[model samples]
Target: MRDRRGQGAEPDAARPTERAPSVRSEGAPAPPERAEAVLPEGVEAPPAADLAALFLLLANSALFHLGEGPDAMGEAAPVDFAQAQFSIDLLRLLREKTEGHRSPEERRLLDGIL
Candidate 1:
């Protein structure tokens, strides 16, 4: 009698007839479809550290202006200013590092911003 696989196929003696381990047996669940995060035209996604720097800059600026006067808040004014400056500096550094490599579209975007 022929095996289940039919002609030329021999039953593997090492494998159980009922449930042989399959190399292709239903692999890990198919990867879920994901939508790419669409950034605005001409802009590339910033590195994590650069984004974090931007966040810190904005957050510090908000904190600084929320109060009436610099002296109104304790030591937060200067500290916030320093934090914001540092973040801005970091952002500038990142831009400088990538300056020459930007595409024409990127240059236009940066020009618009500046």
Candidate 2:
């Protein structure tokens, strides 16, 4: 059968195929580059900034003042639990990202947490 390129061949399913080229190559000619495309107005990109400081600040504050239980105001309940969950999740993410390069302080905190 004729392929899309007009090369006469059997159907791809019936033929043994070679592997496709990798997206990146070693010592290959650089691909043509394009100008950075500006985002359209109102397009919201994900925030790629340090949320750690904020998380750590709130976590520390809550841990210090909240005293580890649901209190008279009940404000501490959700905030404390949510902060704990977020810190645990963040620690897991950090471990996965760093592949276990955590600092001693981080390890201590994470050990206490988990």
Best prediction by TM-score:
1
Inter-residue clash pairs, candidate 1: none
TM-score of 2: 0.28
lDDT of each: 0.54, 0.58
Off by over 4 Å in 1: 1-79, 110-114
Each prediction's TM-score against the native?
0.29, 0.28
Error of 2 at 103 (Å): 12
lDDT by residue (1-114, candidate 2, tens digit) is 745653447755677779878786887789897565578999886443443443455456456444565556764444455666665576567656755665667666555544
Give the candidate number with the greatest lDDT.
2
Shift in Å, residue 93, candidate 1: 0.3
lDDT of 2: 0.58
